[model samples]
Target: MLSRREIESYESQGYLHIPAVFTGRDICEMERDHEFMTRHWASSGQGWTGPWRKEYMDAATEKQSQLVAMHDLHFYAASWMQAVTHPRLVEAMGDLLGPNVELHHSTMHTKPPETGHPFPMHQDWAFYQHQDGRYVDVLVHLDDTRHENGEIRFLAGSHAQGALEHITCTPEGPCTPHLPTANYHLKETIPVPARRGDVVCFNIFTVHGSYVNRTSQPRRLVRLGYRDPENPQLGGQSHGRPGLMVRGHRPNPGGLHPAYSSEVGALDAFKAVPEPALVG
Candidate 1:
């Protein structure tokens, strides 16, 4: 659980960092999974260009494609799912969002050197629907994330207000069509530096994005979206599109994961709505 001070920091700053959430072995296994998947995609004659090809491109080099479709739909089963669902990480989320929460979706952003591009500024909630209370996103960095590596940049206290309308800029930088409700708050952008094992958590409404990787190495990270159980579902579209909802754990069942321990059970706060449920 996060300390009161830590929680306050998150509230005021819109994001917080937790260090060493994984072990060296865990990182090794995840990297192996990434390498295996990239090689598999390359060998398949996919040519690393298309709808899902972005996943293969190295973020630091921008030489590889971005957003490759390597793993099956249920990202929770991907190589890094174990680390993504770590107990400490879960408990901290439960602390902020309450004991009951559901894993909404998972997407990986693997930026390569030189060619890595910036993620446009946008509100995650603008894409997700939640009838419950608050929504949270946990970003797990597989590699050391730094400013040079195109780490995340966020505006503090942006969540206290609602979503801001966004428009495309001439060069493709994120531009708000108008000022956010938070208003002229000095547009502060801070880079969240994380170690190999650290995870960064933030509210959904927070305005955040990342820059192109200037370094020669890859910057890899997984973004998992979670929501409170009782929150009302907003009538809209699915954020992860196509993959849809997998079965949810009842009362947040923990044994669903083979690696789950007594201290950690399933997130009790949510019921997974099926993909068709959105239209239903």
Candidate 2:
């Protein structure tokens, strides 16, 4: 949990970065898990399951790598979930929002060295459904993030109001589709940088995006999602294949299942969940 001052900083600044949220060892383990999945994951057969399935590795890896994109959902599995859903994270969000929250989603993002595209600026909840008035997202950096490497940049406090409608992108720049003029203007443009163990938390309605990675190193991070538990899943068919939470509850009951939930541990607590060789 954050100090009173820290929460105030988040309220005022619209964002917060908890540094050293993971360790170098933790990062190494995650990367190993990723590489193993990539090398062995059949480009032509079946798919991944269990721990890796969340958008934070919550889904599946495509059979082949597409140009400028190499996404593999649920790459880290439940272990990654533990990192993404750390207690401090839950406590922080609880303070900002409330206690009745559930794991909405999670996604692991990676920009390979020298080959990642820019993510256009936009609002998250505007795209996803949320009945509740409040929703939160946390990004855990697996490496040193920086502006040159295409770190996240957001307009502060835009989350206060609801979604800004019909914002369109044009050759001139991003603009709104309707109305006499644009209410959109950057209040603050800050590049969120953090070490391997750091986590960046922000509001769902905030306007944000990251540019293309220009550096020579891979940029990777885990995006963990939390929303009010009562928010029901809206009826809709996903264009892409989807992963549904069959059933479960928080504070994992254990039984060799990756999706099980458990209590949040110490801040420095991080341990690798064992698995077979990435290649079957």
Candidate 3:
């Protein structure tokens, strides 16, 4: 569990970098599972392809840059299923998001050696919109991260400003939302270099991004989104889907979610039951 001072710091700074939260054994198991996922799963390029990316990376680096990513590790790997619900992480989540902490989602992000992709400055809110800033993104580092290896950078106390307007990439085929390159510069943000087993936690509203990895080694990290169950998600990623409880019991059980619709596409989510609770 985090100290009261640490929790206060996170409340004030809008982010907290916790070092060596996972043990060597834990990392080894996760690493092995990640390797297996790389081989079995259909990982794809999830790099941000917008004009904002150009401002963060050079033309040559941009061409070579690629991000290997996949969502929801729990479905495939038991090791990760256990890792996401690790006691230490759950305790931290409880500390940040109150007693009842529910997992919104998790994703594996592996930046390949010497040309890893870059992300533009933006809030996770554009992807998953919650009514409040209670959602926390916990980044579990499986490998050491440095400036040369695309360490995540955050604008200090930017979460205090709440969600900002994210623009779509016009020329780019898919609309990847990001803040304007003119205002949110990479140089102005603070880089957070972390070691293997370290976990960084920050509010979803916080503005953050990363650069291309220049090292010969891969930078692996798993992002787990945990939030207060009562946060009431509006839309975006994991919309209307039920979340796994990692800490205390969920508030107001057996209720309708906003993502539910009469459309057949929402059938599974609509039929989901609260009895077989996924308690972490």
The TM-score obtained by model 3 is: 0.90
RMSD of each: 9.6, 12.8, 4.2
Which portions of model 1 show Cα errors greater than 4 Å?
A: 41-78, 131-133, 168-187, 235-280
Residue-by-residue lDDT tens digits, candidate 3, 151-265: 9999989999998999864764656899988888877889999989999999999999888888999889889999998898888887878778888886656563333344536
Worst 10 residues of 1 by lDDT: 44-53
Residue 195 of model 1 has an lDDT of: 84
Go through the candidates in order and give the clash count of each: 37, 19, 0
Model 3 gets an lDDT of 0.85
- Local distance difference test, candidate 2: 0.54
TM-score computed on alpha carbons, candidate 1: 0.68
List per-prediction Cα lDDT, in the order shown. 0.60, 0.54, 0.85
Give per-residue CA lDDT, model 2, range 44-101, as digits (tens): 2222211111221212222221112123334435555455455666677677666555
State in Å the error of residue 96, model 3: 0.6
TM-scores of the candidates are: 0.68, 0.63, 0.90
- Pairs that collide in candidate 3 are none
Error of 3 at 236 (Å): 1.2
